[model samples]
Target: MGCATGIVKYLVFIANLLFALAGLALVIIGILIKFNVSDATRVLPSDFGLAPILCIIIGAIVFITAFLGCCGAVRESTCMLTTYAIILLTIFIVQVAIGVYAFLQIKDQNSFYSALKTNMEKTFDQMDRNPEANETMHVIERVLKCCGVTGPEDYQTPKVPLSCCRNIEVQCPSPNNDVNSDGCAIKLQGEIEKNSKIIGGVAIGIAVIEVLGAIVALCLASSIRNSYRRHTYA
Candidate 1:
């Protein structure tokens, strides 16, 4: 009986660990979603465009894992808990890989945005002369202006990188930000921060709670298995 309880405890431990890991992952993703790309020198990445959606989905999964882990840990079931723990570990590793890849992607996006901005600046005048270039430049400049930079400023300072456009206070996606203030700049910085910070930070937290839950499960499983072995041998 004592051994059995120990085994069960091991299983519970594994589950708890997995769940904690999952929860951590969720918060990380939530953080990422809130982060702003303009200041980060990164535009919305093409490949990572779906990252926010994926984080939300993963966060839900982590929350569910927490619940399951809590249940298994309380029940002290070795085999079941062990299975959960193993699964959580696997997911955790995968999440780490995804995080690394995402960071790399952000770097790549930053570089790309810089290059694109430079090229755009160089060709802005030509755009007016060429119909296609005109349309493209008009659209691109509009986005830049909306994002907070003065298009004319770029002409004065050609040495500045793409990020120079970021300082201009314009209408961001945040609800509270009023684009029509004095210079079409954003207001309510707190609101802006909350919404922007969710992107990169949240993306890093996938499967965190699940890892914690797995740890809890491991404890429960160990306890249960030990107990079973002791009784069966006796």
Candidate 2:
């Protein structure tokens, strides 16, 4: 029994250490995505824009929960182990929910694309009169390295925005060779789809890990409680 308990204790500790590292990786990924998408978020749907923040929050929770599990394992505290298990179970449920949401969003990519295209078109049309729209479009075009909603042709003017140029150093709105012929709508949709897939995959994977962690925590807690009971009776 002692040897079994010792093995379980070390297993719990090692599992939690891995969990902590995973949590930190998640936080870093979230931050990178947040910064990478900051310019595009201006036109993105509210739910899509919130994904990075959700990732950050979940990562923080996972880190704290893993820390608790590590301490509990080292101290052989049944109370802490039980608490950790409950928290892990809760996180697991939340991660599954997020994963499902992300996949559903991916499944409805056509509708998502349509909505985004419409939004961008509206923004482009209003750019002449709306200062905010103009600024947003400029940032989107420059960062995305694309032209108008559909392409430079979408601009009725003979000279498109300088941002449409593949090389701003050269004379823009000139030959096709100097311009970015791709459409912003397509580029933006591709980015969103890629992000959704990533979020779904990562969330599902972590949820599986969380379930295993919860099971291990519960088993460890049970073992510790039984050990205590045996010592008292002896």
Per lDDT, the best of the predicted structures is: 2
Residue-level lDDT of model 1, residues 41-146, one tens digit each, is 2222244346566666766766665556666666655656676678778778887787677556444644645444544444454644766554544344344343
List per-candidate RMSD values in Å. Answer: 10.2, 3.3
What is the lDDT, from 0 to 100, of the residue 3 in candidate 1? 61
What TM-score does candidate 1 get on C-alpha atoms?
0.48
Candidate lDDT values, in order: 0.51, 0.82
Per-prediction TM-score, please? 0.48, 0.79
| Model 2 C-alpha lDDT versus the unseen true structure | 0.82
